[model samples]
Target chain A: MTGPISGPDELSKREQKALESLLFRLADDEFVLAERYTEWQIYAPTLESDLALANIAQDEFGHARLWYDLLGELGYTEPDLIWERPPEQWQHSTLVELSFPDGGWADTIVRGYLYDTAEQLRLEALADSSYLPLADRIEKVLLEERYHRQHAGNWLERLASGEGHDRVVAAVERLFPHAMSLFAPGPHEDNITEFGFRSESLQELRRAWLDTVIPTLDSLSVPAPEPAEVVRPDATGRDGSHTDDWFELYDAFTHTYTELENPTPVRLRGEGA
Target chain B: MIWEVFRQEKKGDYHKHCGNVHAPDREMALMFAEIQHARRMHANSLWVVPQAEIAEVDAEEASFGGTTDKAFRWAMTYNDIDASFAQEVADSEKEQEKAAKTREAQI
Candidate 1:
């Protein structure tokens, strides 16, 4: 009642598929990207960075859970929905699924920088979505992501000015191609836009991201990557094609959950048995 | 070091336990507490106490007769509060007033 009561009456056939695609993109992107970020949990250059990354990972996983819960309400079982998906069936952007190659602090910083900027645009648009549930979810997600954006911005400033400037610049150049691919078109993007689920097209969001990120990189004296001639992929993630990194991520994240044969007993906080 | 933060939601309200924050000093603790607890615009003000400065008591050590009886201290003890309860309270007040008067006279 506080905001607009502009949500759909009930999801139509096209609307349902659009919403499902949106949720899959958002949920899979965050879940998979958070898995990659967790690899830096103990290896970050600074303790504060480690804690910040861990917090970001937690928020991403939390966002994924909220999306998964929404999916469950739509009548999909959670485990089957998440674990049953093949790598090629995931809808996460290629940017999120890219590997950082263990290139040390610079790679992590650059990855966080690019992903946070892109995610901010995507999430801000989703925050205004006509879907009430998705809008509400974005409200909570944006709060945490604001911190992630700030963390990335702060590091971008520091690394771009400090002795590690060249290293960060190099990493940016290497990753920007895949980062731009986050906007690769999916089959349902036009329907999603037409339904008012998102206000902007993928190109528009990418432009907005560049507008926001380029100036900051400029201020930090970090050179931005040149825009590629051909940004589309014949077989890219937005169209459900993923790299081997997706399998790596799926394996890492689902390790513990897959190990149990039967339902595990819940353990109380201080209980030994 | 860890600092325990207590937040007052409005003016003149008692500070309630919000959460703990880790910081090296009072300044950092204040910064973290402001962001962690107060960023949502709910907190009016906050008090941060170093974790080490807090004194804690366990309820188990302070139990009275395993909770068998402490009815005299509770309002429910006077379940039948028609006339006798008022009379009893009046008598107690009178006794206290008399005792105070006697002490004053001695003084």
Candidate 2:
């Protein structure tokens, strides 16, 4: 068993690099996905659903904040990590960067279901992380993620019973390949695993995710792409390459900070504030 | 009879009033509450009590926590004393902060 790493100074160069790689993936994925979720703020199917989705978006942002704050312990500022950073430097899965089709509520719920299931599995893997900061925050993040999974699963079941079924199916088919990128390892996978940053390997998390999600989707009558048939997208977003949509989103989100000549990003208190 | 349903979302969590269900009796009220209020939500357990059994004292009946300021009871009143040194103290301060806002809204 690995001992608790109290802070950045405790890590070697290789360990630091591995931690950075892991942090970038976790932070970027949540930040981008939350940005996408904000698009449905007023445009969701109903006011109640709108509020629910908006809360989920805020939860994702809060989770991102936790990861980004961990990175700060290594001497990086928020501007250096986000607003002022180049779009290509981001290491999120392309799954989050893809734009939602207009009024595609089905895509929102289905994407959430896919992401949350994978998130639960991966967070569980990090529950006993030797990195003290990471292990400390996992429980709170996991608690919030449970609500997200329940929200998505509730929507998926309700939608599948009505005219929304076809839309959900289309979303599943169109996005499955991209969603698989969630478990695709970064270059520091071996270091991340060997250092006990995460107790389970990405391959194990991926298999567990598939086992849980496949049957859940099947039960809803929404056909998921078979595990063997999932091909990684050309731009997986883990390698610093992303689709054009990511650049567009990056520009929009950072427009204010870029134009102001001040790189400070605004912050609000409370988890969902 | 109308029976109000309160849902405990998870273990150790407080039960909150969700909504009321129409039923002929207490037993049927619980059965209806399970389907209506607890069906779609993540509820660990639920309680259904007859609406009439709940006594209420509205604003017109009684004033709550008094109309005068009771700032001395608040942790924030002694803001110079740092609560940050202890997590429990900080948590209590936060709860008091929320309670203060809620009391203000009530007044």
Candidate 3:
């Protein structure tokens, strides 16, 4: 029988690498997606929805900061880890990197619903992680994700019940495949699973996600994507292969950092600088 | 909907104002507040009040100012209590003692 899993300090070499990769994927995906969400800060259909999206974006950014801090403790400078990396070096899932088409409010809701469902699944699984620090962080993240899931579910219900329901359903159908690809096994997936960093495999977590989401989608009269079609993308994100949008996203996100004369600070500044 | 959340760090402690969260209703507000505030610490309990239900009284109102002097009600106004009140208390105690002795002798 397997022994009781220990905390971050007790992590094995393989486990540490796997955890680092997972953290990178989690943090980068949220950070980049938050920028996209922020684009709708003033453009949402309703003021309340706009505020909700912005709030969620801020929460995601905070989560990224937390993960980045973890990465720093594991021997990586935050700026070098986030800003200096090229687009191809990023490990964010393709679902988050996809450009939200100017397809109006329906498209936005569908995208939000898809991303939230996937995030909820990943976070729930991570909550049982062997690493104490990761498990604790995931628990905190899961709390916020509950609201995000509810908000997305509410919008999905509204769109499915109201006019243009068919259009929204079609949009979701088109996006579901990409959403499934969010769980594509990373380069260190085998090591992560074997080392007990996560209690479940990538495929196992994806299956669990589908079990919950497919039923909900069916209830909403939206068709779910087939499991076979939900495997790795033509450009696998786990292998550092990403779409063209990733380059644009990376450039835009790191523009300020790249333009700075001294991107990394060597000494302390004012009180909170 | 806006919820104002007050959180208590431990049992028997007073709940202090933490922050606000926007939700569709009270249930969602509580859920969001639990996540936003209490997730990081040892919060024992939370009190959530709807933003609309909160009543505010302006302390800056000019009409509510006190018009009369009520200085006599304040202890600070009766200065030199050791000199004035102490003698009065001693005299009163002596009178009470004399009355008690006369009553005892009559009995």
Question: Taking the tens digit of each residue's C-alpha lDDT, what string does model 3 give over A44-162?
Answer: 86555677777888888888877877787787876677777767888877777777777567777777787787787777767777666777788777777777778777777778877
* Model 2 lDDT tens row, A189-241: 99898999999999999999999988988888888887787776799899898
**Ranking of models by TM-score:** 2, 3, 1
How well does candidate 3 reproduce the true complex, by DockQ? Answer: 0.08
TM-score of each: 0.69, 0.73, 0.70
DockQ of each: 0.06, 0.02, 0.08
* Shift in Å, residue A229, candidate 2: 2.2
lDDT of 1 by residue, A1-273 (tens): 023324445777788788788888888878888888888877876554566677778778888888877777678875666765556788887767767676567877788888888888998888777778888878778878887777676666667778889988888776777777778777888888888888778899989988987787788787776565534444467778777777787776666667764244353332354
- What overall lDDT, based on C-alpha atoms, would model 1 receive against the true structure? 0.76
Colliding residue pairs in candidate 1? none
The model with the greatest lDDT is 2
Clash count of each predicted structure = 0, 0, 0
TM-score of chain A of each: 0.87, 0.96, 0.89
Ranking by DockQ: 3, 1, 2
- As for TM-score, the candidate ahead, 1 or 3, is 3
Question: Which scores better on DockQ, 2 or 3?
Answer: 3
- Candidate 1 to native Cα RMSD, angstroms: 11.0
Please write out the lDDT profile of model 1 over residues B1-107, one tens digit for every residue.
88999999999999999888776667657756766777656878999999999998778668745666666677875676567557888999999999999999998
Show pairs that collide, candidate 3. none
